[model samples]
Target chain A: MATLELRGVRKTYGTGEVVKGVDLSIKDREFVVFVGPSGCGKSTLLRMIAGLEEISAGELLIDGVRANEIPPDERELAMVFQSYALYPHMTVAGNMGFALKMAGKPKAEIAAKVAQAARILQLEALLDRRPKMLSGGQRQRVAIGRAIVRNPKCFLFDEPLSNLDAALRVQMRTEIAKLHQELEATMVYVTHDQVEAMTMADRIVVLNGGRVEQVGAPLELYRNPASKFVAGFIGSPRMNMLEVAVAGHDGAAVRLTLPGGESLAVPARDALVKTGARVTLGLRPESLNLADDGALRGKVEVVEHLGAEMLVHVRTPQDDLLIIKAPDEARIHPNQTVGIGINPARSCLFGEDGLALILRVDALA
Target chain B: MAGGTKVGGRREGRGWPLLSPAVIVLGIWSVVPLAMTLWYSTRYYNLLDPGRHFFVGLRNYDLLFSDPGSLTAIANSIILVASVLVISLIVGTALALLLNAEFPGRGAARLFAISPFFVMPPVAALIWKNLLLNPLNGLLGWMMGLFGLPVIPWFSTAPMVALIIIVSWEWIPFATLILLTALQSLDSSQIEAARMDGAGPLARLRYIILPHLGRPVAIVVMMETIFLLSIFAEILTTTSGGPGDATTTLTFLVYIRALLDFNVGGASAAGVLAIVLANIVGLFLMRSVARSLNR
Candidate 1:
């Protein structure tokens, strides 16, 4: 096991900077995922860490040693590319044993190691077949087997499951999680899918436009996002954001007028909020419930009947759209008026600067 | 229903009528000449004595097999094609790898490297014969003089070697162009994976790049063999099968017999022999090299 640290790592292509001063410390045996939208510099950062791309300006430390000038092979890291990158000409066993052969290991030793890795990946039957002869899932296992034979200090996955179909991606996702548990190696994975990040990552680093937006545990990022960007990004169906104007602030809480002219009290200190100031109110879909005596009113525009739950799209009188998660059996229909109830404790408040304001303890309770 | 069936039969008959133009052109261009050649090869025909012709079954073939010059021509043809293929493939692979790397002026350099392939065969032969390898005052002779070395006569002394060098120079660009295109299509991530697997440059080249290039290289060999067997203009323009028939290949021998000696029967027999040889080589290459690639 090894700890990986990136100190102010930067990458620039010609004049355009792609990865801007990303600083992170990954602990031993930790599964850290870099998650973001397309062109968010998450892949670039991962490549830099893999030594596939040069580190433009900062130090990459592996086990407290600077490894900026180290070649990828010498860096003691194995990367699983999205394309799988298996040697098409060689058999599965040959591909797995290639590194050992290149390092001048004896034939018997290489074969033994390859056999062990095949046993681990359940690829013993495929050892004699070439990559072109294998299915997509088998090729993926061969790719992992190739990495397993190396026994590197850390494993880097560059969106490894992006090419698989939906069902297979889910199956392989669990398999990878199990592999991590078995190997217990420090793994760094990059993907644009937040669900993968939420499901597989021990800690998730959310990136946007060449910069890290927030880095925290998946649930921590889901529960307490640092900015409006993260709040909208971390959760499925997206967190509903409504523009609000502060009506007034009491000594312990701030009273805000929603877009539909309804007022609610949010637990925010007076110093962090001001009277007549504008802010965005963040609420997850699950945080909003349907109540008979709720104050806020909206018309249901659409109803999505998922098997386990129902997603109700509501349009308020202020013309703002909000999604509410309801039970599958909930009787919701389009063109019907409904009340949306918000729990103040599960809500977040973003100031004019887009930074999350401190929520008072009473509201969190 | 009878009228409709008649009309459909008429329409079906129209297909051959429409296709007759291409068929007629191919018959005149290919089949008629081949038939004429086949007829002439079985007879004793001489352009110099057209009225004294007679059928001579297998006599011309027997004469060709018995002629010592025919054996030399066959050997020279095999040597020329094999040497050029070997030299071009090796140099072309190296040049393709060099051009594949990231460097300034790479585009212009690639264009320059492939420029020789576009040069006319006769023009390339003449340029090498007169300006490059002429023993008296050629550039190579001048370089030899500068080094105080003997300025040996290239074409006169080493005609086969000179022919091989000139042909390889012209054909290397073709091999390089095809191989370079194949090299460019290689997935970069595969190379990166190999590198991450602790493969150095040599190992990567051996295990990845060469294997990826297998099909294209086979194609290059097949195409080059087809063209290399019929190499005529260069031999005609430069050596002319001189120096005691040292550089006389099968096609050159055919030209000498048909055009110079006017021996129609003998030339036709040799032409048929060349076709048989080419087909045998082509079949072997397809079965051995191309099939192994499985492209």
Candidate 2:
């Protein structure tokens, strides 16, 4: 029954503010991921929640109680660091049992708890071996086993899988997801990998420059991003944004001229856009198709053929480079001139401030 | 087999030539003196009457083993080394932990903590004897006078303790610097993990910090033991084996036998014993280091 609430929480180091007024609520047993690029203050926010970093301002509540001044040990939170952070001198069982021993648990209780955690982590056979004798994945499991033995209220993971190889990372990702189900504990994970957030999170909070850009389910963020930054960041093979001039507005829909002088209309009933005002148009690569009467014309510059699909890099008439996902069997060649069609209903329009313009369904049709 | 033999032959041919100069220098510097000492230990050699020397076999060694002064010297040597090792290791670890914490003036504090290591042994002994612990006009004497306590003559009454204090002061910096470096190399994330695991300060030190420092502490002990086994300069400068050989360590006793009494054979036998003792300790230290490395 652990829940976390942050009210205008901030972290300032000297004159530079790293986490600026992050207000969030994490539900009980929810796996919430803080996803962002490097230096986006995601780790700092997690550290603050872990009570490892001091909150420069505002409040943090755990289970409906004010916990800003509490030390990490008393806060009942466990963090798995990227480096695993296992004690090299101790055996796996010892490392897992240290916290319980420190809390004055009897030797039998500590050993029993450690044995249970080792069994859960499939580390029973390795309990007597020191950390240096374990492989990277084994060490990581020991770190998690150490955390599990404590049975904290919340689990915080700071890029825990970033140190593993690509194959190991995917394996550990599934392991972590399964662990979340087994424990049913509230977990706050921080990572720069969008795919990890997309696959593992119940909800992902996207941050940029120490501010929360958007928060939603993975597909919701992928389908309907709230900002141009989110639209570009949340999706693989990122959405291409082109600068366009507003042709006119018909009170219900706004019309814009593309870079190649092709005009398109988008639903923007709530957008305060003026005629002749320059705005940005966002088009996902998958939303594009090859049509005989397509308005946008471009020459294919490069072709990357994956097993199921091909990424077509196109140069438009306006010299803008764009990516188009084509069917794998479609034998496209470089320097081939083609007409690329954009689906306006599946597109997005951003104002000069990079804020997404709310779209009405009828106008989208 | 051919490939292995070729590689081995090439390595032997190239390595031996490259190592020739070092081997030659070591042979001249160490082996020659050792051979001379071995020869001298077997005869009644004396600088005072070189022409009257005779074959003594193990007589010098027997004399050394039976001498009450040599026994006192051996005991004093063990006491000094053991006391200095204990004091420096405890104080050094504490200082390292203190310096590892973030605080104002930490850089300057570390500089001061490591300054004594740079002081030469004789100079350090002199500074302690004259400026810090002297019975008449030293700072400690003045402090005792202010408290209405009698000034205790350190070298006269507590010569071994005085020597231990002086040696520990000089060696503590060496231990502190090594331990501090080990402390710095400790993964901060591990400490943070310990905190998150419900361990407080003392728990973290007991379970994490001390265990992590094991290898570095072993190294410090090994190095300090090697140097402390033959500590001569401090005693020569300050206590000079004291009022009744209270602080006459093995090295000082050998110096007295060879230079003062001109009993070269006796001194050489003592030197041979010191070498054997040092080797036993070195073997133990090497085994510990090797075990840690394997771990």
Candidate 3:
């Protein structure tokens, strides 16, 4: 295993800079995942590390040696692409042993290694079948097997499970995580799906607009996102933001009036702003519930029941449509008035510039 | 489905009647001539002796097969087809590979490489014979004189070789275009995988690229075989059944037998035999080269 370091890595096309100065150090055997939205330089950084794309400026060190000038073949790293990219003409055994064969391994040795790998992957029965004859999951396994046979120092995965159906994606994602544990190899995976990043990564690197926003443990980012972008991008159904103005100010606590003119106490003590300064209160859907005698009031626009849970969409008097997760038995109907109590301890606050406000949360008494 | 099939069949049948005039004309022009040739191939009638003839039981074929002139023609035909196929596949595939690479002025280079295929065969041969490879007056001859070397006879002693060059000039362009198209469709990811697997350029070519090209290579062989076997104009213009009959291919041999030897029946027999041989070769190539069936 090798510790990979991308030192001041920058990528540009023509005159436009895409990945602007990204510096990341992936420890050996670390399952680091680069997570981002589309056009965010996650895949671009992965390609640079794989040597598929040229590093316009900066150094890549693998195991403490410069690897910028080296071609992908000599990098001692394997990649599993989104398309699988299996050699269609070859049998499963041949596909697995191709790298060994190319390395001039003896026929007997190649045979032995291929068999061992097949047994490991539980693909012994399919050794003679071509990739086209295999199912989507089988093909993906073969793609993994092809890389596994090489025994590279590291593995780079570019949205490897993106092509599978939703159910299969979860299954394959677990398999890949187990494979990483069994192999104990350094892997830097790239994906736009935060679920994949959260579930599979030892450390998740959230990138946006060609820059690293934050890198931390899955729960670390979930519990305390450093910025508004990271906070909104990490969770499903997304976080709701209501524009608010500070009505009254305390030392560490501020009384803010939400868009509906309903006041709530928020913890935000950085860059002391005058009264009436605008801000956005970040509230996750999961934190809102139909509590008795709640303060924020709105009319129920729609309620979406997903068998296990219900999603209540309430439009407040200020025209701020908010969605809150409710229990399956909760009664919510269209055009009916609804009030939601957001768990103040779990919500976040941000200034007008989208910088998350760190605070010791307390209510203004 | 039944109604759709019935309507399609009725429409096709109606279209057939519409095509009757062209079909009838082609039958009279082509089919009747082919039938006449078949009839003539089995007869003993010569053009000088009118229509009366006895049915020859493969006597003319035996005579033609046993003759030295016709044997020389058969040998030259085989040599010419072999030499043309080998040279074209090698040169065309090389040119195609070079064209497939990223280089400056690649579009111009490709157009230049396939230009000879569009040139008329007679003009190509004449250009080669007079100014390119001619012993006394060609470009090579002139270059040799610049080096103060004696001019060597290229067309006479090595007329078969010269014929090969001219025919390859015509066929290589077609082969190169087909190979280029095939090469372009090959996925770059597989190549990268092979490379990441530590496969050098040659190993990648041998294991991955060559196996991938099975279908296209088969196509090249089949197409080139059909076109090269019937080489006539190049042999006619350059060699003219040449000194010692070194370049008299099957088609040219058939031509001379009818025109010069005044043997219509024998020529028609040779023509029928050539066609049968081509069909047999076509079938053989098709049978051996299986489909790739790649996903």
Candidate 4:
């Protein structure tokens, strides 16, 4: 129901600028997740949007209204904190009904709203219990229920699921996605877990070192990253990077010599390719496969079986280790010589700068 | 079969021997004086008439209770403890909240705020008696004179008020120290969440900070009551229970019977009454504290 716009929003403390000039526009009902490594200011950016932190410079607009000076509660936005920050002295019903009480709502309205939220979060029987009596997952649900009772214009989550166990993290992840579908409210989520970002967000904003690296759909960022940082951050079993030199150019592609004396010609901008210039080649683990008479030859160092897929770590003759994702049933073992094939069209090339040189192309192109 | 059946109380009989040293020390320290006081309270023993020690079965208590001054002294004790407790708590909580805020020189300010507690009781009374409330050339008199107002004698005119002020000045620092420590442990995220929930400053204090300080405030009340109930030094130094029993409390009444009147049996009777009164107050206070803590 609200569109959030941050125009050159920067946060500076003393002399250190933590969130340096971020500009983003979140459309109404869009689930936007800010994904970054720790200390990349993703949480700080979310706090600024929540009005919990002051925007030192630049403007923040909510639904086309200037909201930088508005207080958090006045902004009509609810935030779920990582710590679950429930009032330990209050009962679950009391905790969920606090915001409504503060707004001077009638007692009956507050009770009804809290009841509805407790039902939505499946916490009917635990209303009288305090936070200390509940498990971690229940506390997390109470935090979300507290926010849900507010029925805010947007929802801001600051790594809410990061504190749960792995199994519970996945469960809460899907529950939050389902909640978003049911509410149709704008959500700005922040997490270091790219998997959560990939699964929950309609659009992902990748941040690194206090700057937005790229913003796009999940598959779009996967297929066409804007820079080396985004490619390394957005995927699990990170994209492999190798230092290569430009061997030649073929019309719209750049030819490069990879490790183990294998040559790869990846489609990149021809204008940025220079003969004999040093470049970086980005290859996802799935882009490399085991094949007979493959270009790149290596010795398998380790094979990891992951039920449906196995990751084979291959050591090239030059001591360069590369990982290849293969079917779990593939007969791969340690200390075996293998030839690894590369998919040229799916590969990425970077010049001296870490900016990706590949243009967005069809997956089968 | 006996060992198996005796499952709970003193099953091994080994704990008492290990715990005897402290028990013996405490028995000699407390039980002996209490027993002697009880014995003396029932006997007609006077230091002036040493040869006339005889059993008098509640006669001393009856005489002491019949005196109207004894009633006044009891009321004075209650008034002093109650007023000091109220003043110290309200002022101490305000000071604690102020000191908890982040400001330059806060460490130095906190050190100064709790410095009055470090001064011994008699010394604090002496300072207040001579320098501050002294009416004749004291700092307060000088300040009043500067405003072209007549100096009002504090000890002679309002002796009980003077005593309460000096005692509260000493105990407020203690309340602040405990309450500030409690305030410091309050989670910052809780405050931020309340702010996000639209609680203003006063609401935050009412709903969050005060409830967070409930246990510490109870401790302060119990401890201050224990000490303030037996307040003697400030009364002795400034008012000496003076201006015709205006500031006389139960403890001073006991002192008067024993030392000033040479009536050992009567003083012992008053002392026993004081102990009973303290236990009664302590029983109620402990029950309330236990209930709050359980909640």
Candidate 5:
């Protein structure tokens, strides 16, 4: 296993730069997931690290050796493409053992390695079948097995599970996580699905607009998003954000106002508040509740029952909609005026520039 | 509504009236002549003299079997088709691979490559014969004089070689065009995946591209075989089976017997033999290739 590093790596196609000045270090045996929205340069960065794309500027290092000039074959990295680009004519055994055969490995060793990988992937019965005979999930296994036979310095997965069905994707996700642990090889995976990154990554690098927005564990990003974008991206059903203005401040508690004569005295940031500063208040769906002693009242627009919980899309007097997960099967009617409980402690406040306003523990206590 | 209906399921198998236009055209254009040929194959019938009739049935067929000229014609036909098809396939597939590669002015190069197929066969034959391989005045002689190399009598020393060259030149563009289109449509991602699997250039070609080209190569071979088997005009214009029957093929032999020798019975017999030979070859080939394609 080798430590891979990218120092201000850049890539441009014709005119517009696809991967712009990226710097990252992947430690040995570390599983790093590059998570982003589409066109955020995650796959391009992974390809650059694998030496598939030419680095326009800066350098790439593998095990302290500058590898910018090395070709992909010489780089000793295997990539599982999003399409599971298996050789159509080759059998499962042929697809997996092709690399070793290319490398001039001994016949016995090639056979042994193929058998081992097939056993790991439960592909013993499928060894003689061609790719056309295999299902999508089986083809994905073959694609992964093809990568496994190389035993390269690192394994790069470009959304390897995207083509499988939902159930297969989850199964293969777990299989890949187990494979990483079993191999203990350096891996860099790129996916637009943050759930994949959140579930599988040791450290998820959240990227947006070709820049790394935040790098942390899944729960760390969920609990303390560095910016509003990360806040919206990291959580399921997405965090709700609404524009708000500072009404006034009262020591640790501050008064905020919405449109149409709406006001509430919620908690304040440790930093000094400006009266005219434009900010967005973010609330997770599970953060609010409906109770008799509630602080904010809104008309229930849509009520969705999920057996275990209910989601009420509540419309405030200012016409801002908030989705709250009522922890029980609350049979609420739509168009009925309902009051919502508030927890300022669970809500996040962002400045006009979308930077997180770090909160203190003493104020919540 | 009653007239517009398709009638009964019992009338399903009796749909020939619905197909009568096509059947009538085919009968007029194809079946009638084939039946005439079959009838003529069994008689001494001539279009020039309808009354000079005799039932000299097996005589013409026996004469064809015994005649060394007719046998040599059949052999030459087989040799020409086999040689030309192999040559065109290799040359065409190589051209396709080269055209598939990314290069400067590749579009113009491809246009130049496929232009020869569009050249009318007779015109193409004339160009190769009178303008290209002509012993004295052609470009080959001119180039030979410029390079101080001995000018070769292309038609005399190697008659079949001349025919092979002419056929390949005419049909190579077509074969190359087919193979090139197939190569262009190949998914680049699959090849990239192979490359990442540590396959070098030769391995990629042998294991990946060749397998992908299998069905297309089969198609080129099948289509080219049918055309090459009856290559008549090129030989007719160039050698005309001259210099003691050195390049006489089956079609040329039939033409000589019917048009030159005026033996319509012998020619009809030879034509039947030619059809049988072609069917044997085609059936032998279709068995293998149809495994990869629809009949």
Candidate 6:
């Protein structure tokens, strides 16, 4: 078992700092995914953990021991790169056993370990095939098999499924999640896809502009985001944001005025907001429903049918574009005037500083 | 005919008119000289006895096979090419690896390293014979004397070795440049993966870098073999076929027969022999290069 802890770990290239003072602790056998946009330093943080990039300052501890000076091989971590990076000249078996051979393992032992990893990765039939001879999916499996043969303390994956087709990406995602369970080793994964982060991670760390926006379970971040960035990033089709003015405080909720003079009272802590102050209203597409006599009035702009569910884009009277998810049976058409309904308890309110006001949810109670 | 073949044939038909000018020019340039050489090889022609020319089919071949000096020249040709090819490849690979790294003045250093290839062969051989390899006052001899080493006269004592050295010096830059370009194309991620796999510097070179360089090295070998087979200027300037026949390659032997002895028939026969030898070597090298490229 291995526990990775990063205390104020930073990476700077010349005058610019890419990973600016990150503090995190990954528990043993836990799968932590670092998810962010491009240039958010998620991959840079993974490289620093793998000892591929030098940590500019601060300390990295592996299993409670300071491992700042440790080399990558000595750190007992294996990485699966996005490009696979398999040795083109060597066969699958040779690629898997190279690390064991470098560590002076005997021939029989290396062969046995390579065989086991190939069996686990289902690469036994491809043992003699070079990397160029393998398909993209098979090459990805061999890259993972090479990492598995080493039996390192932790596994780091850097956007391993980005090069795959959509179907293959889903298939490999499940396979990687299964592999993590079977190995029960600490893993640090980096991806820009929020769905991959939500589905595969035990804990997800959302980064923006080289800093952690929030860190929590998938549903926890979904139900109660600590900032506007997390709320907008963690869902598909993106949460529809509208500017509003705080009307008043109502017990545990904040009453707000929408753009079209309609009001919304969202269930959140009222201490961080003042009346008549402008704040952003975040409504998930799934939380918004189409109704005949609903509160918010708008014209249906576009209707997208997905067999089971339909996403209807509406332009409100205030010219704000909003997406509402409806059932397939809802007869919605473009340019049709319709009223939209929002779930107050599921909605979120953000102050002017882009920080989400805390939500008082039933799950927390 | 198949539709695909018909389409391909039409495309080639259209391309031929555009390509015929170059093709015809090259055909005449190579075929005319070869025809003349073949025709002259079968005749008994001499500049000294110009009026006594006649058909002497295979007589020049018989005499060339019987001559001891001609056989020694053949052996020396093989020795010079083989030795120079080996030395240049090994030293070139080492220098390419060294120059691939980051260092101060690396741009300038690479410029200096590759500048030797720009020097004309005759000029380079002159510099080596006078300023470097000369026994009396050359830089190499003076350095050897400072280190308390015995200095032997290079051209007079070991002409074949001296010729090999000069040729290797000229060819090493070509090898290094080709291999360096191939080295740059190697994926940096592959090296990092090997590093993370616990391979040290030498292990990475043997297992990763060298295999990556295999195809390019084969190309270097094939190109160098073709050019090295006809090496003439360096030999003409440095040792001029040696104190005896020690450094006379087949190309030099041809020059000696036609110019020094004025026997056009003998020189043509030697030229034919050189062509046959070069073709054999080229065939093997091309096959090996194709194999490596396919790999």
Model 2 chain A — which ten-residue stretch has the worst lDDT?
A: A356-365
List the candidate 4 regions with Cα displacement exceeding 4 Å. A269-271, A299-301, A335-337, A363-365, B1-12, B147-150
Off by over 4 Å in 6: A361-365, B1-23
- Residue-level lDDT tens digits of model 2 in B1-295: 9999999999989899889999999999999999988998989989999798888899999999998998898889889888999999999999999999999999999999999989999899999999999999899999999999999899898988888999999999999999999999999998998888778888889988998888888888888999999999999999788778899988998899899999999999999987877888799889998786566
Off by over 4 Å in 1: A250-252, A268-271, A359-365, B1-24
DockQ of each candidate's interface versus the true one?
A: 0.82, 0.83, 0.66, 0.71, 0.69, 0.75
> Which scores greater on lDDT, model 3 or model 6?
6
TM-score of each: 0.95, 0.96, 0.91, 0.95, 0.93, 0.96
Tens digit of per-residue lDDT, candidate 4, span A169-229: 9999999999999989999999999999999999999999889999999988888888988
Summarize candidate 2's per-residue lDDT along A220-319 as a digit string, tens digits: 7887788999999988899988899999988667889988888988766656788899988888899788665787889989988997998888998798
lDDT of 6 by residue, B1-295 (tens): 6999999999999999999999999989999999989888999999999899999999999998899988888888889888988898899999999999999999999999899999999999999999999999899999999999999799999988888999999999999999889888988888888889999899999999999999989989999988998999999998889788888999999999999999999999999998888998999999999999999
lDDT by residue (tens digit), candidate 1, A1-365: 99999999999999999999999999999999999999999999989988999999999999999999999999999999999999988999999998899999999999999999999889999899999998898999999988989999999999999989999999999999999999999999999999999999999999999999999888888888888988998999999999999898877677889887879887655537778889999989998888866657899999999989999999999898999998886578899999998876667889888889754344313
Provide the lowest-lDDT 10-residue window in model 5 chain B: B1-10
| Interface C-alpha RMSD per candidate, 1 decimal | 0.6, 1.0, 1.1, 0.7, 1.0, 0.7
The candidate that achieves the highest DockQ relative to the unseen native structure: 2
Model 5 regions more than 4 Å off: A248-255, A259-269, A292-295, A328-330, A359-365, B1-11, B46-51
DockQ of 3: 0.66
The residue ranges of model 3 lying beyond 4 angstroms of the native Cα positions read A268-274, A291-302, A335-337, A359-365, B1-31, B49-57, B144-150, B291-295
* RMSD (CA, Å), each prediction: 3.2, 2.2, 3.6, 2.2, 3.7, 2.1
> How does model 6 fare in lDDT?
0.91
How much lDDT does each candidate structure score?
0.92, 0.90, 0.85, 0.92, 0.85, 0.91
Clashing pairs in 6: none
lDDT of 1 by residue, B174-278 (tens): 999999999999999999999998899999999999999898889899999999999999999998998889999999999999999999999999998898899
Instruction: Report the C-alpha displacement of residue A257, candidate 3, in angstroms.
Output: 1.8
